[model samples]
Target: MDTLCSRMLLFLGLAPFMTLAATPPPTHQFTLDNGLQVLIREDHRAPLVTSHLWFKVGSADEAPGQTGLSHVLEHMLYKGSGKTCADEASRILESIGAEENAFTTQDVTGYHQTLAPRYLGVVFELMADLMSTARLHADDLAREIAVIREERILRTDDNVDAAALEHFTALAHFANSYRTPTIGWMHDLQRVDAGELRHWYESRYAPGNAVLVIVGDVTLAQVQPLAERYFGVLQKRPVPRLLRPVELQLPGERHLTLHRDVATPQLLMAFNLPGLATAKDPHTVHALRLLNALLGGADSARLPKKLELTERVLNHVETRYDERTRGDSLLLLSAELTDPPQADLDEVQARIWQEIEALRSTPPSLDELERARTRLIAQQVYARDSIAKQARELATFQTIGLPWRLLDEDARALAKVTPQDIREAASTWLTRERLSVVHVQKGGGR
Candidate 1:
């Protein structure tokens, strides 16, 4: 009934989405002699276009001392670059009615813009300048660091949920660069100077370490020349592959109870899992995606159905399993508790583990498995409706060592996920030893 209602909502204009076929669009992919890869997809549906520049460098690449350098450089690019200061960059784009922003993730830092198709050359020039001539001015670095520190206060220090996630992930991985937050520690940011920023930038921002994604209102015939003219001039140097520390094993179950001033308590559990880039079994990833959908949403979801129908202490349950990473990642399940809880937390944990063990032992019924795959397919269709998101998706795949065609392959692969695969994946990857649990406490209580 709920699934039917959701489809009804989709038909009633409450949901807008897209599902590109496995074939994808007619994208022209090529590389420059300077080592930059470019993907161009033409969409003449609108007069708008989005240009994305993805640097294949992120927090994972940062050494112990240079945490958040990728994010810091993202801010510095906006503070100003080359001769086009932030003001000038803003003025230039604003004059042409452009929307622009940049973000850093675990495996990639990307800058993007959506603007009139005619402004493609303009963006190319702006990005090319930043790529080569970023000033990393001392005053600018200090000011931005202050801005980021305040951001930290709001996002991590004051927000207990965010703080808990930080500590949870740190303890979860224990020994990899993934343990560090993308937003570097306040102390590290305080000490990072222009020279340090410049060094990180120059080393990672080379043409060899980048992918340019263009979609909408343009073709490669029109974009290739401008790309060459603006970006081709940059020097070609082999991108230094950073040493990636492998997690040989989880030492044991790790747990943290964070006490802070808050209105309610929350519980989070995560398991270390292989990423799409590094996974030995691709089928497990597809099965995991279906498994997350089946276990996360709707009244029928495993977490909610068991806990909620029984009227346990949980106010809500959410499970997220994103396999997009350059290395190991996680399958995370989190829940918010009803205040002044009536249920025993240990009992709740036991029940949750039981559901996991069931998945490992019994293959889900065919109907349930099909429902999970259907929801997964429908959501993907809805997620790629925006030209900007499409371009971003393209760049992200390349950055994470995933082929662009994987986007199309996903729908096809998801359909092939069998119940047996889910059982095996749950049993193999979601073991007790790989799990880390975090409890958020509102006050001074165990």
Candidate 2:
């Protein structure tokens, strides 16, 4: 442990933004009478400010039949609003040398603007109008739908890994809305109309359900007045509570093979796990983070060292653990198998399973555990350097109903994680019955 910690400290000393004592902490928050939450972080090192707005509604909150309504509305928000034309908003921002964009995820939708301090007023006005007074035109909706369809075709239809991942998620959770793609099923998108999109916009885009996060070369005194002038006038609505469906407990192991025409064979193994917000113990989340770091996170990780270096059975290997907004999460391990004889497939599967089983039976070495903690801490410090990343992390925590401060706590917690906790979490969650294995084969049709 001492050697691992020392190595981590040495690495942190050399990496950018590792000197946390000099970094400013975010500290201001206020709520409007209408229920909009506002958070402001002051950093006067630069002459620019980043304004971010987060809406709590996401795919999970969409109406049962309207699978991709949240995402569709995200596109519609930019069509036109109030005095702005379809493309006028972009032009307005560009004229001021500002950058703006929006994205929708499983649990939240966000819009952000980064510009010189002089354009802060412009940023606020544009966002407020888009959020409150967007007028969706019929012709614009038609054209945007076409664009979105094309995006889906390019992103999912033509891409092998994207298609496989989409299918895997859909089959992984039976009752959860996470099963649905954010872009929505093609059939659902085709059936969505302008009226339905408008209704979704009005219902979910309420001021009460939004949060305003501003970070950069400004203070609360200067920004709060501007925020009130532009956003405070918006009326609030009765924001509906998010109702998440319960996912049935996995009774046994589930295996799915999705064959696609691809250049290489890909294997994805996922296990059901608890999310950060609802894990049996908060330490479980930290342990899982460390465990993933040791397994497939770094170039020196276990799977890469074993598969790529020794066994030579895989060309590439990686793992990801998503502590999603929902209480149910997934631990995914993917590998691109080497070109081998047909008889070698079973051996490859056995090797991967053995690694998983080993984690459950034995704890990670003292060195491996320390290295993982250091890397995780370094990531947290690095993330703080970008205003956009800081905003997103803060918004993600708030959206998931976790304390925004947990961002810091999570990093610290990782440092305290012990080997025993990792073994226990693996034994508890990564069971055969709770796992889903997906195989993608070349030249094999669905």
Candidate 3:
């Protein structure tokens, strides 16, 4: 076991976060009078604390033509509030040698900060003001919109792989909101105004709809009072779930071919799978997670070993599956063509399917499954080293309508996932009907 830990630390570059045998700190949960949810994890290793305030509204919650409103609002929140003006909140945190940032995703918008434990009250006061009494100044919104436009161009428009993935996501889901990009459409960004952002913020960012997660150098007793003093006074409002159309299980595979100016071709294969929120059979989510790891979670996984090392057809390959979502999740396999180009995309696709077939037809050895489990468990353990990451994990689970306790149970579930579970998951979920194949070919002027 010690040898495996050493190897994983070196192989994964996780040595800095590795405290090989230490257990995670206990996490406590509470709800305020105004319906604000609070989660506190006591980590006394350092005198620093990380706090995450997550709202259950994101790009998926936006109506058509108002996409990216959530992200724009995230940026504008930094511009000012009643107590802080024009980046004053950031300046305050920076003055205290703290780090702060926020992100907008498909299902949530999170604002986070890491600072000395004594500054916990300061962060809470600033964030509470931003949440309830934010000054969505029109000028600030205009400037932030411009910044976001450039962000969209740099991140998606000019970047070939990102553009291809955007197109692929659109083609893959019919009624699911995941089809919408988090950055939103370029035209929508042009039309979104301050009034729209204010309405979006008021309608979504409420005490009832937010979760506050704190980790590191803090006790529940210390945090509960600060949380109540700053945030508990806010009035709770009704934040209804946005009604989105259900994704129909349509027959036939979806394929997209994009032409871009690129040095090497790329292939992306994504299958729509059930997430923690959508899965009817609970164990399916864990099984799919393990299957993803076994396929491409590491350099030693099947895809890298065969395609990159043995077949020499691809230079890079990776698989991604996130079960913590309010909607259906995507299990993605992405690869890049080798330099000098080995095989055409057609042959590469065939070889990829052959590997999937191998897992579907025959189960893996117990040793193979155990290795994948160990890799996943080790990654989870390493994540605990960072208070920010720890808080985010708790917030994500709670915001997605699951208990944070699921974090501890995940390893046990993964351990119970047998070889038969792997075969069944691959055979059931990795099907043509569920698959979306996207090819980014070398070309220009598309």
Q: Cα lDDT of model 2 overall?
A: 0.79
Q: Per-residue alpha-carbon lDDT of model 3 for 1-446, expressed as tens digits?
A: 57576555544543323334234587788999888999999999999999999999888888789999889888888777789888899999999888999999998999999999999999999999999988998987788889999999999998877888899888776558888899999999999877878888898898989999999999988999999999998988987774332466653588888889978999998888888878888799999999999898789999999999998989899999988888888888899999789898888999999999999889987667777877887888878788988898899998888898888676666657889999999999888888889888999953
Q: Can you tell me which runs of candidate 1 are displaced by over 4 Å?
A: 1-20, 242-245, 297-300, 309-312, 444-446
Per-residue lDDT of model 1, residues 197-248, tens digit only? 8888888998988999999989889999999999989899869784443554
After superposition, candidate 2 runs with Cα above 4 Å error: 1-24, 244-246, 340-344, 444-446
Better model by TM-score, 1 or 2? Answer: 2
Q: Which ten residues in a row have the lowest lDDT in candidate 3?
A: 13-22
User: Candidate 1: global Cα-lDDT?
Assistant: 0.80
Could you estimate the TM-score for every candidate?
Answer: 0.92, 0.93, 0.94
- As a TM-score, model 2 comes out at 0.93
Error of model 1, residue 393, in angstroms: 1.6
* Residue 154 C-alpha lDDT in model 2: 91
